[model samples]
Target: MRHATYNVNGIRARLPRLLEWLEREKPDIVCLQELKCADESLPIADIEAAGYGAVWHGQKGFNGVAILARGDAPKLRRVGLPGDPDDSHSRYIEAEVGDYVVASLYLPNGNPVGTEKFDYKLKWMERLGSHARVLLAEERPTVLAGDWNVVPEDRDVFSAKATRHDALLQPETRAAYRTIVHQGWTDALRALHPGEDKLYTFWDYTAGCWQRDAGFRIDHLLCSPEAADRLRGAGVDKWARDQEKASDHAPAWVELV
Candidate 1:
């Protein structure tokens, strides 16, 4: 099956592009992040009209996540990563699509270091790592797909030296991701495109980052060992970033057999 993850930035602002993508890609399932809409405000009718059923965890204007399965709505498994009582951002949502469990995540963008947001980001990472372990124990086809907000390595970004201090590319964030991978989760994209460099998933909106190809590969598809074993192919849809009024991040995907 073909599954895709996209950080649409804002569902309302990008609805047209999203519809176009659904028609073009026709993925069996789609995981989305940064919806920026409350549940009541989400365009459920539009999604259904596009031939998919969705389960979403939405926030007022910030983090949000949703899973859309073709034909029928997926069984809602959980919302938000486990392990934090005070954490209430609508940044994580998971569902069961057939035998596989899938989730769309919006990891905290820890900008301007030395702030509460940065600390929150780090704490969240720990929770996510724990949650990933639980999912890995299931030994089923599981996928944690989303805007991970961590640059896995210097090779994944355009200019590692320039972004070394950035929150997404920082040593702390990288270490957290490394720990997750150590638990036997596979970095699907890297596995597919090993040795290739400058593979980015996000570009800054300002400073003409897209034009200069100044970007970071912060979005990802981390697969459990079972799912990774079935991985057929994976890549980022770079063409989507060239669309008019395109989101800063493009769609990334994986195909499993």
Candidate 2:
């Protein structure tokens, strides 16, 4: 089975590109982030027409997430992280698909070093870590895929110096993400292509980042041991990112036997 994660940026605006990718790649399941649409506004009909059934957690003009299964709708598992009741952003959602449990998440981009947003980003990561432990304990085939918003190491980015002040490369952010992977979840792409630098899943629209290949690896598919044992391949769908008016992110995927 093939599982993919993409941060579409905005679902309504990217619908055409999305359908085009669906037809081309035909991933068995896909986790989408940054939908930036209201619940009632989800283009359910259009997605269904493209042969995918989806379960989404949407926020009007900001964060949102969803899981799409090739045929039937994925069985809803949960929405939002469990630890914070006041955290109302629609940034996390999970579902049961086939024999595996999958989750789609959009981690907070806590920009500017000393601010509440950065604090919130740290706290939210802590919550994610706690829940990840529970999922790991379940001992089932599972995949936690999303735009993690963390640059794991200097090698993962084009130039760490360029993004030195960015929150994604911050020590706290990297540590939080590291804490999760240490719990036995495999970082799919890295595992498959070790030592390959400049492997990226996203690029900024400004500064000709895409043209210059100044990008980083943020979107990831962390697999549990059961799933990792069957890993066949993994890569970024760069073709999707080259389209006209493409999203800043490209789909990153994993294939399991």
Question: What are the models' TM-scores?
Answer: 0.97, 0.99
- Put down candidate 2 lDDT per residue, 132-240, tens digits, no spaces: 9999999999999999999999998999997899999999999999999999999999999997898899999999999999999999999999999989999999999
Error of 2 at 27 (Å): 0.4
Clashing pairs for predicted structure model 1, backbone only = none
Poorly placed runs, candidate 2 (over 4 Å): none
Candidate 1 lDDT tens digits, 1-257: 98899999999999998988898888888999999999999999999999999999999998899999988789999998888878879999999998889989999989867888889899999999999999999999999999999988888888888877789888888899999999998999999999778778899898899999988888899899889988999988888888999889999999999
Model 2 lDDT on a 0 to 1 scale: 0.95
Give the Å error, residue 13, model 1: 0.5
Best by TM-score: 2
Model 2 clash pairs? none
* Top candidate, metric lDDT: 2
